[model samples]
Target: MQKVRGVVARAKGEPVSVETVLVPDPGPGEAVVQVQTCGVCHTDLHYREGGINDDFPFLLGHEAAGVVESVGEGVTNVAPGDFVILNWRAVCGDCRACRRGEPWYCFSTFNAEQRMTLEDGTELTPALGIGAFAEKTLVHSGQCTKVDPSASPAAVGLLGCGVMAGIGAAINTGAVGRGKSVAVIGCGGVGAAAVAGSALAGASRIIAVDLDDRKLEWARGLGATHTVNSKERDAVEAIQELTDGFGADVVIDAVGRPETWKQAFYARDLAGTVVLVGVPTPDMRIPDLPLIDVFGRGGALKSSWYGDCLPDRDFPMLVDLYQQGRLDLDAFVSERIGLDDVEAAFERMHHGDVLRSVVEL
Candidate 1:
């Protein structure tokens, strides 16, 4: 066992406290990763608010890049000293989804079985099963995807979750193609990523819609062809006008609200695809839109689960693309801070002022 410094949320709606915890040796199909850096994401805040579950005393932090420090008995895919990105979904090969050759939908995805605990022996629940807001984190061997060591951990770490989700929303879920016109609503981390994904997929007219101009400017930096401040203009009208008055080939609702989803629905051309990457609250409901609209729209209205990404296949390829100067992962990292700054990072996330604040371990 090893003692490592980590940030833990002791209870709901409480500030995370940093403490030294015990990380046990990896069991079968597991590995110990010495985390170099991890990004503070909105999901971590969700956990703190008990938005995810009642698993209190939670060890938060997940989007991270690290070095494999050790491996369990039967592990062969990765070993000590390998650079890797931590993924939450450790797909089980024998699951029903994997048997159908769609491991991305693997229902039996899991994390390290061994638990990380407090000094008093209280069990700590890791966020998304990663618990990366620590010096070291234990995870399933499948959760560790090997990547180039030369890449900056702070930059590549974002790919483990939000960045990958956004890119996959367009490239994987939306199937954005060359010269396709795309519009993405809510230009935060996820929305900007969809814009970048569309751009990388050779989208000719990438329109971005957001309530904040600051975010819209950031969206343009990430490859948005046009920007619309929805606070000042009708988002659907703006998107439609930008896309030849017929709307885009694909419209992604990164906001995940019924209002935004409806905008996404009507903001695309006939038979256009709508990808919902944003998450919604349980109290929220989509009350309007006739059933005929669903049938008449004529294309897929899909929800991207973690951008529909298969981590092993997507992470390395994206890192390589970043290395070749084709994809700019570094731009997403607005700042880097220590573990203590997570609470402040959540505030920034609320203000929509920054893209991502990474914790450099």
Candidate 2:
């Protein structure tokens, strides 16, 4: 067993604590990763606040990149010393989704069969099956996606979750294409990424909508062609005006609220697409809207699950783009912090001022 210090959310609505935990040697099909860096995503904060579930003493980090330290018996896909980004969706090839060739929606993703435990012997639930805020973490070998070691771990790690979801929302789910007019609502990390993805996909007019000017500025840096302060203007109207009154070819709602979703639905031109990447709370419900509007709009309405990405296929390609300087993955790292500062980072994220606060191990 390996003893490692990791951040843990001991209870709902309590600050996370860095505590000593026992990480067992990898069992079959498992590997141990020495974490280099992990991004402080909103999802971690959600886990701490009990927004995700009642799983207490939860290990609270997910977006991470690391080097493989060891692998258990029967593991052949990765070995010690391989640099990798940890992915939650480790596709199980025999699952229904994988059998049909859609591994991105794999019904049975893999995780380590053994559990990490607190010193008291209480089983610890790893956030998203990847408690990576620690110095080292154990995961299924499939969760480790090999990438270029030379890339910045802090930047590339973001691709493991939020950034990947945003980019995938545009490229994979929305099918954004050349000269397409795109609008991304909410302008947070995911929305800005969607904007960047739209630009990368050769979108001619990328409209970024958000309440905060800072986020709008960040979106512009990432490649938004227009910015809308939604607090000061109607998002749908601004998007339509920017698109010459036809609305955009694709509209993405990175804010999962009913209001933002409604804006996205109305901000698309005829036969345009709407992609919802933001996560909603369980209690939230879509406000009533006419079914005729849904049918009359005549466009696809979809939700992006981890940007509908296949990590093995997307991670390496995105890393190459980052290395080539075409994709500004580094811009997402608003701050680099130690593990102790995660709670503070969570506060910053809650205020919506920063894109990401990455914890360097």
Candidate 3:
């Protein structure tokens, strides 16, 4: 057993604090990792707000990169000193989804058998099974995907979550490709990544739509060819105008709101695709839509779960792209903050002041 300082949210809507956490030795099929860099993603804030569930005293922070410190019995995928990115999808190879070869949608992912706890012996629930905002964390060995040690930990770590979700939304789920016209709504970290992915896939036109000009500017740096300030104009009409009145070949709704999703549905070409990578709250529901319109639309309306990514295949390839200067992963690092700065980073993210505020240990 080892004692480590970690960020914890004790209750809903309360500020998080750094507390002494008890990390146990890696049990069978598990590993202990020394976290190097972790991104301050919105999901952490959601966990703090009770938006996810009533799991209190949550050990937050999931998007992370680290070095393996030790592994338990039968753990061969990673070892001491290996650099890796943490992932939640630790697929059970025998699960129905995996047996069919769609491991990305693995229905039986697992986490560490033993729990990390508070100093007082209270067990803590880890966010998305990672809980990496600490000096060290314990996870299922399958959660750690080894990547090139030469890559930037802060840059490549983001591929563990938002960045990968956005990129995969475009390439894997949306099938965005050369000569395609693409538009991404919301222009936040994930949305901007979708724009970048579209560009990387050789899309002829990439339009970014957002309410904040700062976010739109970030999208441009990431590879957006055009931007729409939805607060100033109609997003659907602007998308149509930019796509030669035909509409984009693929439109991604990264905002995950009813209004934005409707816009994406109408903003794409008749045979184009609509990808919803954004997550909606449980309280939210899609409003009434014309069933006739749904029948008339000959395109797909899909949701992207973790961007429909296969981590082992995508993570290394993306790190290579980042190292090769093909993907501007560093641009997403709006700021480098310490563990204490997480509350402030959430405020900045909520206010649209930054793309990503990473916590570098």
Per-residue lDDT of candidate 3, residues 167-211 (tens digit): 999999999999999999999999999999999999999999999
Reference-based TM-score, model 2: 0.99
Candidate 2 wrongly placed segments (more than 4 Å): none
Total clashing pairs for each candidate: 0, 0, 0
What tens-digit string does per-residue lDDT give for candidate 2 at 142-209?
A: 99999999999999999999999999999999999999999999989899999989999999999999
Q: Global lDDT for candidate 1?
A: 0.93
Give the clashing pairs for model 3.
none
Q: Rank the candidates by lDDT, best first.
A: 2, 3, 1
lDDT of 1 by residue, 283-306 (tens): 889859899988987888999999
Worst 10 residues of 1 by lDDT: 280-289
In candidate 3, position 346 carries an lDDT of 93
Residues forming the 10-long window of minimal summed lDDT in candidate 2: 280-289
